[model samples]
Target: MVENAASATGPSIATRIGKLDLPAPTLMGSGCYGSGEEYAPFVDLAGIGGIVLKSVTRFPRLGNAPPRLVATPSGLLNAIGLQNPGIDAYLENDVAKFAERPCAVIGSVAGFSVDDYAYVTERLAARDEIDAIELNISCPNVGSEGETFACDPGLAEQATRAARRVTAKTLIVKLSPNVTDIAAIARVVEAAGADALAVVNTVRGMAIDVETAKPRLGNTTGGLSGAAIRPIAVLAVWEVARAVKIPIVGQGGIENARDALEFILAGASAVSIGTGNFTDPRAPQTVADGLRSYLAERRIASLRDVVGKANPGFAGVR
Candidate 1:
């Protein structure tokens, strides 16, 4: 049944991740989108579904040294080291500002241990302005320990369970692509109580300077994002979608609607835009507009109709 009688108005782009509902399916990826305010001047925040604020840890971090970003042929490598003002300062100074955002405000929590996730999530999700929480267990740029939770199934389950115990708000667990069996990890996370999963964070990669025979980034290794990781992310979403019942926020190298559609077809309920913002801050609008156009052209009743349409093994909830 067409929920909206106006079929000509185009298919509904609205989507749900756990208890949270979004008018648009396009979300600005965490870390890439800075608090939804910085890009407000260049793009309409209302045009997108939500903004995943940069990850905040229990303590302040100075971030990595200079040369944090390196543009490759099809992608960019970055090692920013999760710089933030710590939970105390963020709650006191920054959480209040999110109240003005036109779209859903999703807070991101990064930590060194399970306790850190619980502490930050309890405080951040307690804020009325925050619509949801994203547990960033797959930050590859913060050194070896940074991605430990995401790569290790036990730690991933423990961290996710810890955060789940603190809040009833939607929790999206970010998984690492560097792992050997991502779907297995996804299953464990889902069982541990993640409402939704951010399928496949940046692929681990590094670039070196030939002349100096040294690593280009100060951290030596960085997470790669952009067109380079789309296939990896898509496959991860496909496999994880088949292995779990929770919604999947497909991301990686999504730059346009077609790129996002690939994930939706592979069983992702929604898509996230990160490096694409760097290519063009208006990328979110372009994707949102393009998705509506695609639906209108196909006469699809809603974007949900196409979720997992291409993947036979998809197991996500409608």
Candidate 2:
């Protein structure tokens, strides 16, 4: 167990992802925290860094069928299929509500084509409520078309560049962990003008039902998250950090401050909590507290001082 520090005035966890300045380094992962409203009753919205709203597409999606979620031995598998109201409806009903959120509100845009990315990003970022735009180019549950932009370097560049052309607001391209060379993709996306990179979306996996002799998820295959992919996520952040100078929002199986610290040591500027929220609604605040305690114990003045401390190959700003 980590010992609590008497005072949290020692190190600063504030971080900047692109142009968005976060008071804390913890961001709530998209699809996990719904616009920062669902968790407000249980957790303090202003205590965390920011919230990446669920991915919104150009068209409304029905999402996947039932059995969209399954608990694995060490993680959780999900195939939500980017289910959300279309951008039109989102702008009308959702965007207005974000004005009241205490923390940063990052809009997530997921699409099937480069044009779709540009269109969605332009509209979403134009709103005053959105602090930044996260291009979810690597959604694993929507079948082959979903992850195509992230797998193909050319498509990744095209999508990133298209979105870049539309919005000067921070453009964070979410990379897929299913790729063969994530570092290469990171370089491509960076060259195309991405302000930051979301190290990994989720790892692909599936479960079989013994009695039914069929897949458990409605989509057959789902993206695996939680501790199961922590190593993979850390390695991805490490490699991408060395390959690009942009900031990285590290995620994947991060459950506590210790888990979040691993990504920071591996070169991530910030950490995102997704599945961790399910374990505890107050996980975000706990992580923030734990990070402060860890830094205070070591007499560290700021969290940035320890970024990439463990990775000798880290190329991001120190």
lDDT of 1 by residue, 1-318 (tens): 112223236678888899877888888999998998899999978768899999999999999997899999899999999999999999999999999988889999999999999999999999999999999999998878879999999999999999999999999999999988999999999999999999878998999999999999998999999999999999999999899999999998998999999999999999999999999998998888888899989988899999999999888584
Model 2 poorest 10 in a row by lDDT: 1-10
TM-score of each: 0.97, 0.97
What ranges in model 1 sit over 4 Å off?
A: 1-8
In the range 90-196, model 2's lDDT, one tens digit per residue, is 99998999999888889999999889999999999999999999999999999899899999999999999999999999999999999889999999999999999
| Residue 275, model 1, lDDT | 95
Clashing pairs in 1: none
lDDT (C-alpha, whole model) for all candidates: 0.91, 0.92
lDDT of 1: 0.91
